[model samples]
Target: SSLGHHDIIEYLLNHDADPTITSIKNLTPYDLAKDKETRNVFRRYMAEHMDKWNWSNAHVPIEKSESTSSASKKNGSSISGKSLDSSSSLIGLPAEMRTRIERERRARAAEVRLNAMQNRGTPKPLTLPSIGNVICNVCEKSLVGLVPFEICELKFCSTVCVKNYRDREST
Candidate 1:
């Protein structure tokens, strides 16, 4: 949750609210503390009560109510075991963890696609083959697959070659 008020945080801490509870970004109240005052408040609270905080109790098991179980049966969901509640399943996960998981999944998919493309063989490079007999001004090589650049009708192999030629002329 976005922590804006130090007094409210302190009040919550004084009661029984878990200070270690993280938001979707995996940021706790301490992490979200923006101002020096808020940070100091969190720091002080942590210093005093850090040992008392029960790490195991952080994840409270969600007990399926009778009504929910009966409703699931009526809906004819053949899936066995406790019904998965999307929101409840994510209740313990920090937002940062979720984002990281999603990013990793996308990266893996991209890697698979890249591997598939690679296995299909290298794509043909664009060339000015039709132009014929055009040589790179700098390298003095045939511009086969390499694109030719024209600076005042003087052909070069690439922009880099053109820049190099220009630099040489300027010197």
Candidate 2:
């Protein structure tokens, strides 16, 4: 959801909405909200009906760097106040856990660097095959080095034409 419906959220809270519900990403309503505006709105509604919440509900403690601005401060309670970079307690964490996370991060960085290096290499020039005539499925134009689309052995002249063809099929 885009999180745009303020009135509906207010009504839902009034009728007993659970702010602690964990999303697919394991984020609470307080975590998923992108900005201070939505956080404040949720906080205000929650304050108005604090009795409905089960304060004892266990929520996964998110890392401080992942905390949103408003939810990480104000309202007398902050989920995560400090940046994860400043968290020295990671040194005390079990070696396997720290090593695993560090390894994964390093691997991802290595992959990204590899991809960057590959992209930096010269791009091979697209060549027209000598065998057959390649024609655009949408505009029926002759295809050169690149065709906009390649559906099922079919080619399109441009991105616009490919989208138009898809829309035509859907409608």
Candidate 3:
């Protein structure tokens, strides 16, 4: 949602958010890219992780090159003038304007990161944890599936974690 913000876009992509998803207007993430660099971030990601996703569905341009920055500046867009004004022209703006844009980018990135973290909510058991292999909601330890142990829909790796969860809730 943080359009024009490369870091935020990268973060969302890294977290497995679908990039090819379209808005009501049928605009894709590539369609919403605010600058050549931002578009390149998507391209680079697709290049780095080839088998991870169907990049054709990503809708980003396939022009993979280091000279894309200069090319976009010269041509205004990779889509052969189909796209409108991009932030690539921002290079000609005054220093203060560039600084303001930078501030806005950072603010937007922070807002996106916060939203992403908040949306994750509680850990879903069996779904990979953020760090190590954790399937337990309490201790966050990887559970042995030989036996099922659950309380109120929460899974635990051990009885100790269950006890700890109950003890904390009672306090």
Q: For this target, which candidate reaches the highest lDDT against the unseen true structure?
A: 3
TM-score of each: 0.30, 0.31, 0.37
lDDT of 2 by residue, 16-128 (tens): 77867875434466556655565556766555554667422312122322234454354434335433442342446588756654664555465456446435743222223
Candidate 3, residues 111-159, lDDT tens digits: the string is 4664465358653454443544436666444565535478877787768
Cα lDDT computed for each candidate against the true fold = 0.57, 0.53, 0.64
Give the clash count for model 1. Answer: 1
Screening candidate 3 with a backbone cut-off below 3 angstroms (N, C-alpha, C), the clashing residue pairs are none
lDDT of 2 at 97: 58
Query: Which of 2 and 3 is ahead in TM-score?
Result: 3
Number of the candidate with higher lDDT, 1 or 2: 1
How displaced is residue 62 in candidate 2, in Å?
16
Question: Number of backbone collisions per candidate, in order?
Answer: 1, 0, 0
Which candidate number would show the highest TM-score if scored against the true structure?
3
- Candidate 1 lDDT over residue span 62-111, tens digit each: 23455765776787653654444534333456897555544644554654
Model 2 worst lDDT window (10 residues):
55-64
